[model samples]
Target: MIAPAQGGLRVTAVDSLAAGEGIVPGLPIADARALLPYLAVREADPCADAEALARLAGWCGRYSPLVALDGADGLLLDITGCAHLFGGEDILLADLTRRLTGFGLTLRAALADTPAAAWAWAHAGPGGVLPVGVARQALAPLPVAALRLPDGMAAALGRLGLRRIGDLMDLPRAPLTARFGDAVARRLDLVLGRASEPIAPLHQPAPFRRQLAFAEPIGTRGDIDRALEHLLDGLLVDLDQAGQGLRRCEFSVFTVDGGVQRIGIGTARPSRERRHVLRLFAERLEEIDPGFGIEVMTLEAPVAEILPAQQAALEGGPATGEAELARLVDRLQQRLGRHAVVRLEPVDSHIPERAVTLVPALAPPSHRPWMVEQPRPLRLLPSPELIEVTAMVPDDPPLTFRWRTVLHRVAQTEGPERLSPEWWRDRPGTRLRDYYWVEDLEGRRYWLYREGAYGEPRAPRWYMHGLF
Candidate 1:
């Protein structure tokens, strides 16, 4: 593969055939083409490589919980006690390599006591399992480049005839520190297990996760659903043991082609009900594409909540009220969108328009109650519409009003409720309102409000706020 370099496009990687024909990384494309005119090349995408590496690290979770990205192209797996799961360390290594190789990946791997030692052996020395306490001896013959020194440090050492790691091992600590700072000594210490290097995984491992590996890859929808059910069964058992229920769940399908497909579902409340969760998953099961065939499946609950057991109804029927409502909301959210299912929550405001706000259906119920001291209109306009009014007196309710080009003659009136503007929210000189419940000759009720009091500097303006 070729990529833009300091001068121009250069070979970033090469295939086995290209390497055999004298093509190598870092060589300018011009020189590479001169060596072989018909050479095939593609641009290198660092971003794609990093993403694939992260996915690979996630796939490695089937082996160990602690799997971290070594660099852009390497992965570090701390399989301390997990090696026995696949028989032994040697067997585990073989299995890992075999699976990755089947995915068409070229890999160089080594298992050593320390991360740095393993890195050095994998990149420079022959890849194999290095026994404990053998890193120092095995790495001594490799060149200083294997130490992963800072840029130009290895070249400088080579010019001085200190090309091998054995040379640096015998050098004085003081002189080495003075010449190349502490980087060389630090790397050496790490390889020798003198210093600590902790691996920070690309993604946090889910506490509640279950995996299934099929002996033969399965591609049919029935097989995929069966695997999902089995994984959910195992995961639910874990959640039950912990006295918790999942709030969000993810199902991942690992295809034989090294591609991963994930499907996700969420609950309005924490739940351990298998049938309900299965129903939710059913909504998006068609999204999973079992490319080639799926060899592994994983189910994980990254978000969970404590849910103590509850008593069932005496009649042996499902509990009503909150549980039923929550399930309905969950289904609606899955069918519609997460934001589509919402409830109007009461806001601490006396203004008709500011009395309530839309909130997610899953949101916790507010303790504050809706204002009901006085009757409210059945339907309130988003904004009050202006109207032309003629009243018998300045302080009295309107005798007749023209709204939307239609005149309504008042048959009766009930209120002149005075409401003051909120001092903290309204600006200075803001107007107060006098609201009224008026009935037209046709028996239609209307909520009318006059902004600005009578006889004020600004003349009172009438508005139609709601219908009842």
Candidate 2:
């Protein structure tokens, strides 16, 4: 049971046992308990349910690349050009229903030319295929709720003797529009196929993918490698003909025990070279375990980019060194995790802590140049470390300081560079900072700061901000 907006608990869902005892979704909890005293109930988890639905949608990709969530519980698959591959629409629907049912799911599926019509038929009629031109005939007997209108709107239609969809089909549009507004007419058109409804797939369909199903299951590592190489050969042909390069590829192995293991690899630059892609996957292929033997292999390039034709140099010189460097970076990232490889890029900020940031190694370098007028440190602390300092009363470089339990005597020093907090984002306790560069007697350079004005109610404090 889940709490409803009416301030009391209601049955959001029911199990087969509860349904058989005359309890259904939306019944009051008190009334349900009266029917069955020992009914088991628990609060619903919408987030977990949504995540499971998304995973189910991904799994449905084995049927069609275009699969979308219709509602929290339903799915929409656009199998326009894909029906022929699985025999026909009826066979495909049956196969989907049988497979999902095997996973302990109760499913209702219907096919029509429009999403609205299919949705209505799936909810109201016995699941079956509705031919292209028979949407009106198929939807005539369903209730007004099949049109997917607001609860208030459907109730209003019911009170006006418009119980069946066919009742509203022949009614004058102006009266319906005047009473219920345009939503009534719009939904009617959508259900009857006069208006078009498009399904937005959960994931964009990949441009290139190759799959191979073996006649017999093979668990050996050599067999898996051979299958992968075969799939890659077909995938590369498609990429080459389209003048494109693979940016990322996923290799999936489906085992006979109904489990899938996937290995994904990415590149620093777009590539179509077979040896390079295979080499990247070779490092991680051992991680895949072919439980109960592997039956099918699929290689898909979900990310790709255009690669314009290249011309050979007049002297047939060697390839660009930058390409080799990018390949090396890719290999290192593959061996190490992605976060293990990064590049430091300068950020456009005057504050010392916000001057530069870490970015992905393959990311394009920032076009802006670094500020060189002021001498900045080679390394900046994640946050300034507090310190005790003795200096002149007014604003002068520190004469002596103690940081991290160690005292340092100043040998040479620079001026106090004043920087105030951005006033547009003014907040309480925000204040100006005075930064100074100083060298200790041992030649260790340090960047220090004094927070706030010296004579404020709260005395200014010192901090060591960076090291050079």
Candidate 3:
């Protein structure tokens, strides 16, 4: 119900009825319905409104990187020198407003010497250009409430017959200070373009964006390749200033015909080195199709992380680096997608399969040793299957067991290594298991378990879980 710009309950939206059909923000739903008789209402969604604001902010980025969120429904772009790119300030503003209107957003825009003056006129006075000295005169005619004062302040001032900004502009500062406080004087100074109001833009937005204007469009990958280095050079400067290293990057080549081609590369370690970054991108250059001749190229890093330089000789190995190993890993990964090349990591668990896991290697390999103390099988089945065992229930290894229709009489047995159920995990679907390690007459070793020990119905349906 708040008009975020003025921070008051003011003219926010209206219905098709004559502009003053008694509809406005902060007019309670019940009261509005009583006044209008056929008032339609819907709950305001802060999330949907925020998403729309963010999309508008993205579009505003084309005008300037220093675009700050103005209010819940507005954006403030510090166009500065960026306006010259579209010719002049008037042409820039006109084009921007026209483009946004085409996209179904109704906007009220104003430009002045100061952000505060522009915002004030845009919020209160109708949208237009109030150049320099004319801004104060334009804003002075609007209601005194446009200074963004509180309800009590507005009502108190209204009661005193000072209903316009111009009415109070030339009043004695001492009298206003004694009654309305210093805040009133400061707000008035800001709206009159006397104070410097700094615009705090969105933090560290992507500055790697680059737009290249081409006189002759290049239709082949080779032609765009000549300009690719320059775009990457600009992006490198941005990355250097940001003090970030990239492990994964995407290059988008934009064509004159509104089509885009993207190429991506992932690294074995985070790197900001210009040569190393260029080397990673070099492998994918062949796939870039410059359809209808490319006019712009944008290089972006979607994933990055800190990579501290590692001393290779500290672990007692020769002083050779892992550059070759990293290169091989990157090659395999790029050809087969991320999941195709992986490293086996040891997990802390007693169950053989759970003891080890596969993870995609995105960074340089760590030299940590695999988990010790537990003997692991040469192979692990997808899931540990149930086995029918003739054993001393409650303890000890099975004397004989039936697995996969082949009843193997145990020639030698080891373990009731006493693997207990992981009940602490609250794994509702997991049944209790007791295991045995046994070697058959054929010299093949088998790992088997009983689903539940103390006798139950279906009498232990057996299965072959693993082989070693």
Candidate 4:
């Protein structure tokens, strides 16, 4: 690939065929074409390259969630606790190299005690596992460029006959700082493990997670379900020992083709019931599109809560009411949506419309109790509808009313109970309401309210608020 450079279009990259012909990056495209009469070339797209690199980094999540972008052309994976899953560091690196090579990518990989050392090894030294305490030795022969100094720093060092990392190692720190600033010393310290260099991962690894790798890619639903069950078996044991349960969890399918399918579920309450949790996941398992078959499956609990052990029935009877209700809600949410299953909780407000709010089914009960002293209808309308009414007097209960194009005549009346707007919450000019419990001639009862009072500049407007 070629891109516009300082003087002219230059070779930004080359294929193995062109690389054999002495073509390298930074060589002018004119000179490259002269070297090879028919060299196939394409413009280098840095943006597209960066995006593809980011996607590759995302795919690396299967190996470890702590994956970071090293540079435009590289990825950094913190496989501290993840290598064992692929057998060992040797096997893991081999697997990674093989897979990427199969994808038509020319790449190199190395592992060391520090990211800087690993980078140097992969870019300059022999690429493989560099044992602990050998970073200083392994990095010695590598060129000064491996230290990742500012542009021109490496060429400047070479001009002074200091071309290797080992030359700088024996130099006085004060002189080096006075000559090249602290960049040289800082990078050296980082590579030799003298300073800590933390990798900022794309996503933080969850504390509660389990991963299962398949020797051969598996695409069948039964195989996927079995894998999930096995993972949950181990994950739940950890949660049980910790006296905790997960409220939200995710199941990720890492396909062999570098695609990921995720199925997530949330519980109405913190739960560790194996069967109950599995059933919830089963509802959404069909959504998994195992692209060229899945090679890895991971279960992660991003949200968890403390759930103390509960006493069980001696006869091993059915679950308790709360548990059963919670399971029902979980099932509904899994099939429908997280917001589909909810309960009404009372709010600390006097306005009928603001008296209650919708909350998740398992949300903690509100401290404020319901207004039972003042009778409320079994159901309430989302918003009161306006109605036309005829009253014996301006402030008296409605004698007749028309709602939804239907008319009703009042037979019995019980109220004109006045409720004022909350001064702190309601806007100015917000009027008080007079509510009435009236039974229509057909014994159909209705809750009605008047927005304004009598003798006001504008007459009161009646609204049908709820049904009895």
User: For each candidate, what TM-score against the reference?
Assistant: 0.75, 0.78, 0.66, 0.78
> For candidate 2, what is the total of clashing residue pairs?
0
lDDT of 1 by residue, 142-219 (tens): 999999999999999899999999999999899999988999999999988999888897667777988787889999
Clash pairs (backbone) in predicted model 3: none
| lDDT of the candidates, in the order given | 0.89, 0.85, 0.69, 0.89
Tell me the deviation in Å of residue 159 in model 4: 6.7
What tens-digit string does per-residue lDDT give for candidate 3 at 161-248?
9888888898889999899888778878888878878888873444345555465677775666657677767766666666666777
Model 2 / residue 94 / CA error / Å = 2.2
lDDT of 2: 0.85
Higher-ranked by lDDT: 3 or 4: 4
For candidate 4, give the lDDT of residue 180: 92
Model 2 worst lDDT window (10 residues): 309-318
Q: Candidates sorted by TM-score, descending order?
A: 2, 4, 1, 3
The lDDT, on a scale of 0 to 1, for candidate 1 is 0.89
Model 2: colliding residue pairs? none
lDDT for 200 (candidate 3): 80
For residues 236-293, what per-residue lDDT tens digits would candidate 4 score against the true structure? Answer: 9888888889998989988998877788899978988888899999888989998789
TM-score of 1: 0.75
